[model samples]
Target: MSPQQKALILPEKQGNFKVGSRSIPSPGIGQLLVKVHSAALNPVDYKIQDDGIFVTHYPAVLGVDIAGIVEELGEGVENFRKGDKVLAHGNPSIIDQGAFQQYSLTVATSTAKIPSSQSFDSAATVPQGLDTAIAGLYGKHLGAGIAPPWAKTASDLEPKYPIVILGGSSSVGSYTIQLARLSGFYPIITTASPNNEDLVKDYGATHFFDRHLSGRQLMAAISEVTDSPIRIVYDAISLPETQSVGWGLLAQNGILVLTLPPSVKEDEGKGRKAVSTIGSPHVPYDEEIFRSSWAMIEKWLSEGTIQPNNYEILPNGLEGIIGGLERMRMEQVSGTKLVAHPQETK
Candidate 1:
């Protein structure tokens, strides 16, 4: 029999998660077998368990943010070696590659070495949130089609533009604010609860407004800050209300990027557009851009160009994830990622 490992598994569509056993998978070409140290929870995890979206197989393992040590490397994987600490964006739909397991396989190109400045729990919070922000801001098909800061001639561009990110305290929103700053968007405006004002500003938001404000009120407040047109609006919390706010704030010919389906209707005459962003690098539309971005993640984290989100470690290892996900569904978690130490599971 192959070696076995502990995993949190969903037995069926919309099924409850439970501790289970699965065989440790081998590293295939361009892959690394990682011993998962920390796995971070996201809103999508509970959504998958509740709505059964984006996953088809039974007895599936679900998680996207992973940080761990490489146990072995597959053929053609040259950049990483045994025992290298790394962080990766896991594809939860694939059982062998999911983050909710003690061991899983990770795609080499999408994995980056975790810098000494970050712990496994902190690094685990970055993969999914950062990828979503990247796809929403820089992807041609999935986002606003803006030039990424990593592009060769991006630094030569001179025109400064304005951007608005709804839900600035969210993981995705925070990363979007930081990347927008790197892209040279001036007066980076964001909306969040007043308690998170300092947090979002630290992430590079040039202007902040209370998220509870009405769309008209938000627009009025933003007007007081910048005369430049709002060409891009990223609704990290794409609830119907937030979507409406983002759409209302967008300029003609501007794009409104949404993490969920857009609730606002687009008027053809106005030339405003709404785009739903997919954060997975496994998807073809975002694969290339993610590959390029992944190459720079290590340097970015090490240099403090990108800061990982605030995280709280969960108790009882894998079992604690259930309560954490419940808290997320109940809207109890705020401004922090919940990380579980899988290896600590009993």
Candidate 2:
């Protein structure tokens, strides 16, 4: 085995990264050492690379969504043994020092075994949006189907309530639409550019509003979709402008969920609940809940009930990280994932 392995290194601040070599990681307690097969990128990567956020150190490797073969399991880890294919949002705690290496370390708790029929690329796409969807839907009293814990099922609680998701064209937004539809929400409404209306609708968005349209027109469009008041809304894009528009569209007692913090929180003519989800890996119990949810999601993907959206593959292996971050910094990427393949896996 080689003593050193290749990794994508973000050596300093702002949009500069290069492929570098580092010692292969060994699994620690409750951690699994994975020979990275492929990794998927998120907008957060470039955000940290250029206009940094949650970065603890420099000269780091950046990637959160990972799919790999388990080379070795750390002490006390039992559910996954060597050679199991798995995917996870490995190490959300730090920026840049994640799965963009030949070998990566993952907590067993955050990792889920991949279904046999799933490809590495397919699995790699799960974590980034799945965590948001799973976390957002958990613990909510929805009229949708009652899924066995972690599962998104049609709830008998209330069939008539409506759920709104802003920015349905985004990766997280698309996932929320699919999961919400599965949960039996009567009307799933979302806002996106006109180009994405068909794509978003394919994901089960029963109604689509063009944010580019007039605010009054957008509101009237949403109001025209369903007579029942909007009860829950998850804003995958939480820009101030979107929130302002969202405020007007929300129904009384409707819960507003944001992917990022809303700039303002005034009650907009209706009693509403506002909250933000930073995609924190769930607490132990909640973790188990999502684990089960993803398990069901995995089944759905295989059974064709759910679909995998766009994936932008970067095939330069770990060496591609720098360029990928550069693209992100320039805001050249939209509605896609930037991913790299590990040259070789043991």
lDDT of each: 0.93, 0.72
For model 1, residues 250-342, the per-residue Cα lDDT tens digits are 888889999998788886428999999999998889677999999999999999999999999999889999999999999998789999999
**Per model, how many backbone clashes are there?**
0, 9
Off by over 4 Å in 1: 154-158
lDDT of 1 at 118: 91
RMSD versus native structure for model 2: 3.6
RMSD of 1: 1.3
Under the 3 Å rule for N, CA and C atoms, how many clashes does model 1 have?
0
Residue 185 error, candidate 1, Å: 0.4
lDDT of 2: 0.72
- Encode model 2's per-residue lDDT on 99-187: one tens digit a residue: 88878888777787777778788788778786777677663432111343334344534455678888897888888888887777768
RMSD of each: 1.3, 3.6
